[model samples]
Target: MVTSSILVLFLLGLTAAAVLAAASKVLHVKEDPRIAKVEGCFPGANCGGCGYPGCSAAAAAIVKGDAAPEICVAGGAEIAENIAAIMGTEVSFKEPKVAQNICTGGSRANLLFDYEGVEDCRAEALLYGGEKSCGIGCIGMGTCVKVCSFDAIRLNADGLPIVDMNACRSCGKCAEVCPTGAIRVSGMTMDLLHLNKVDDCLAPCMQKCPAQIDVRTYIQQMKQGDMRGALLTMKERNPLPLAVGRLCPAPCETICRRNIADEGVAIHTLHRFVADWEMNSGSRVRLDCNPPSGHRVAVIGGGPAGLSCAYFLRRIGHEPVIFEKRESLGGMMKGIIPEYRLPEKVVEWEIQTILDLGVDVRNGVEFGRDVTLESLEKEGFEAVFMATGAWKVPGLGIENDDAEGVVDAVTFLDEVGESIDALSGKRIVVVGDTNTAMDVARSAARLGADVSALISCIQRKMSANKNEVKRAAELGSDLKFLTEPVRVIAEDGVVKGVEYRELQYDDPKKATGTPKPVEGTETVLDADMVVIATNRLVDVDALKDQNGEPLFEMDKKTGGIKADKTTLQTSIPHVFAGGEAHTGRNIIIQAVADGRRAARAIHHYVTEGEIPEPKNPQLRVIPESILKNMQVVYNIPRIRVPEISVEERRSTFKEEVKGFVEYDEARKEGSRCLRCGLTCYDAEAGAEYAADPDVSRFDESGKE
Candidate 1:
């Protein structure tokens, strides 16, 4: 019975095998052998420049009528003709093209600032716009080198990228990865003729940036709807984006490339959007550092430079403790700058991030008095960074300068900035054409004071930023330019008015060619109070040694510590100075730059115990050749930044620059960026590698 069961099971298995073999032959859809023959003719580059997935897929698609013979760019016409013969179809080829660097501007372009971030194009592009002064130039980083599947592109001696036309397959990877649009493929027709198109060079606006943030990349990130990415990029250099975004003078806009076309791009307005978005989203930058290096750095002054020093020092595994002789951390940023120009909340938010990076701030501690440099060294501090900002404003040296009701610009702004109501119902006259004078005049006017801004120079020659001049005028301040005050008139030891004379210059256009007082042009301008804004005085007395000698040599002209231009290091190897202590009262961005340099110098000294020589931040200068290669842009109107009407702004201390830009507005403004560094090239069907008719001898039907 077992033998009979086994025989039946074996016969059933045999029948099942017979049916499977028959079904395989009947149901199979055979792949055309010609498809394999056609795919073999391709160069196997698999570059998507042909608009297909790969060579194999492209081969199948061609035989099935889904793809054309001209799709393989790397293989060119020869491969197309060979594939056509295999498929028994006629073929026509589109001229093949190669990639090229469009921008000729390399080291020739002016650099906005020195870049020392990640050595990648994308990473460095996120830095204050980019290190290159030209917004659209090769960053000189080897991202294209690393990204290319074929080793075709290399950086030239001047740090600009060059693509080898012979090896480039037009994969478009380098162009896709370029942050500054410094690489691209050539046009097919142009490639056939060996004509490569080059981009125009340099965005002068980017060159004007002190912080050197890549304005182009940040805007590109924003346009792609990546708010967090934009914020992260801004934070790389500007730790206090929110504060500076509202208050900066924005020299960048003055030299904007868009100016040649129409109005300048509203850079600050777009920055405000990025800053506000980050603050609203509660986005916090995560700090990553190496293990503590067991070094302690003492940073004097909690102003921009000092704060910047502490912030950067902490990031590099050092412990930084800031000593501020104030109730709060920010020196002038918190005390003197008014809430409207830079709101109290924004100040708090921006500085708070620096403090959160493990920085220790000891308020009410004066640098030399509370903690002397000698004492700090004895207490095991590795280095000292002095950044005490200019807290005192110089007197006008006019008669009765110290009379009652006459206040220094710093002291007056400090008081009024805290309470705008303090200037109500008073007549205020500010002496000098400076940021302080403008702020004081504007603030006093906003608080219902009859205000006048006095300047010794002509209106066009005033050193103050043009925006400040315009805003003060719009706020109803009497802008009396070219009027020099000879003395402050006093009554009962209080300022009653200022005695001034109209001065005539030899050249009306020149501000500093010796002025002669016009005969009998003396006049008294009445005032209830006078605020002097002549010059900034660094508080060096606080940082002086016990014997009345300063800790560092003085600059004499700037009235600050004499330090190296790039290193920010004082004469002492272990000591560094920055901000007002080194440069007097310059721009806030300058102060930040000083602080960053001092931090690096201090770190080098602390770790290596040797002072580093000052080196200028290197940037590639755009050549005159490309500078003359101008691209004419169509008139695309710039986005207008909406502001509070004059009526509403005068009544309240609310923000006068009212509205921030939306995504659409920001994108529209960003779209106008002329990609200057784009290096695009194309390949041609060269005289060599002609189609071989000998391939027609191969059997196409497979019947042979």
Candidate 2:
């Protein structure tokens, strides 16, 4: 009976084994070996940083060709290469990106209400925008910190999460968990090309600055005694910091938060101080460039705009060749600006530093004269940037304007450059009241030319740079306000004098007018030379196409090259124009800004094949009510920039404003900055949101 039972059990076991073997063969599924190998290449943290559910899902997607090999951002380049090897495919990687918190407000952010709830940001954000006046600000409840599996983020004392750049793996976990959408995973190129948005935390000074220099960041760096860092901050936007610092009229200072109190922070002086420190340190600040992109761009005009464009182009891995008409770089900065304002040595040092970064600069190479667009394209230039400055001086509509002694500002400055001593004992009368007029008058006086009169059609208060007008007055130039030059009094084709007339305006405040000439106020002022200090127009004749046709559309109003105001692109898609060529005669800082914009536009055109339109305005200006409410009330006096005595200033061609003598002085001046932001300012400033019940959504009874 036992033997029969054992045999029966053995037969049953054999039947079950045969069934299992059949099932195994029937249910067998084919699997790609690459998927498991790709999975192995991943960190296997199951972080969900790759948009997929986990490493296994991402590996499957990568192996199946549904996703790129570089999909695993957490695993980074090593994993990408390993996956590529496993899949036997080439990997196309994106520019590496890091997560950054875009929101500037933290503890300083205006609060809607004090929250006493759960610590999770997601939970608190559900409660009427998470206690912040700005609806888009970080909730500061450590949700991003919790979601970051790599321990890359930690909350600072301000309750703001600061990402540890070294520990960050470029994963999107923290960004995904951010309730306020403040965290941004951005590429390096995008950061550099970012324009101001309405929602951005831009300061008043930053918005007002044409170059878009981060005035706050540089000032903070200065306060920290990081002179090199401050200079680099400025150079990121304005490549010619040393020159711009010396020449900028300080438009940024006019909108400074400190203006609400005693005076604006001495931004111009501090700006020059940092740049001077960099030059005086004897060691140059060198920036790292990307790998060569195998693209070449032709930049016309070696002025501020062209040099700036070349610097930025070289920085982004493209080769740029600057074709300059002059013997050296620094168009107006070197040639037109007096040596006393922007020294030639300083200009040379800054320009050489830009050229050192693999930029090919060809001096004495005129654009239309030596090279044309067709020739440049034939030479393998991918694109052309026309930055030819406004060099053409329009003729005054007076009789015999071409007299021997009658000359434009450019011609006068050029002759002065040749020999200042030649002007000795010569009588000169400079017309107009612009900054150039003041410069011309002062230069002629220094060279021993008797500056007979500095005449203007407008009132003295309406002239450019009142301080400059004051300085010119101190130098013994006769001021003639509301005086118009009717004609050039010439004898034997020589400028004998200028026929003038006195004018009165209906509105004294207005700079412009259709004045009624006083009947008996007309007079002639004797002069050996008459310098016409008027507007400079773009040399449109120089900008021509291969067929000798107008290369760019012209602005009928200004007669300047008509390009896309934002991108600076010309009628021809691949060509661009900037600086005085497009904007006529603007400030040096604005030219630098144009250069930066053109560089960005050209880069996109070459690499991406299209220039992306800006999502918002280039500059974001906060409301006056908001700005006024955000001021930090303090009566700190503006530190006066050390300058040579008027007696010493007149004797030589030296820099007028001596930069901050000591670093401590600069730091002290920097401290006067209100550190203003979009919706927030220094905490010392009285709280507008909390104090005004009408501004808050919650009732006085504390109910929303």
Cα-based TM-score, every candidate: 0.69, 0.89
Top-scoring candidate (TM-score): 2
- How high is the lDDT of residue 290 in model 1? 39
Q: How far off is residue 202 in model 1, in Å?
A: 7.7
Query: What does candidate 1's lDDT look like per residue over 463-496, in tens digits?
Result: 7778788988998898887788889899889989
Model 1 worst lDDT window (10 residues): 680-689
The Cα error of candidate 2 at residue 585, in Å, is 0.6
Model 2 residue 382 lDDT? 93
- Poorly placed runs, candidate 1 (over 4 Å): 1-203, 417-424, 510-514, 611-616, 619-629, 678-704
Winning model by lDDT: 2
TM-score of 2: 0.89
TM-score of 1: 0.69
Indicate the residue-level lDDT of 192 in model 1: 18
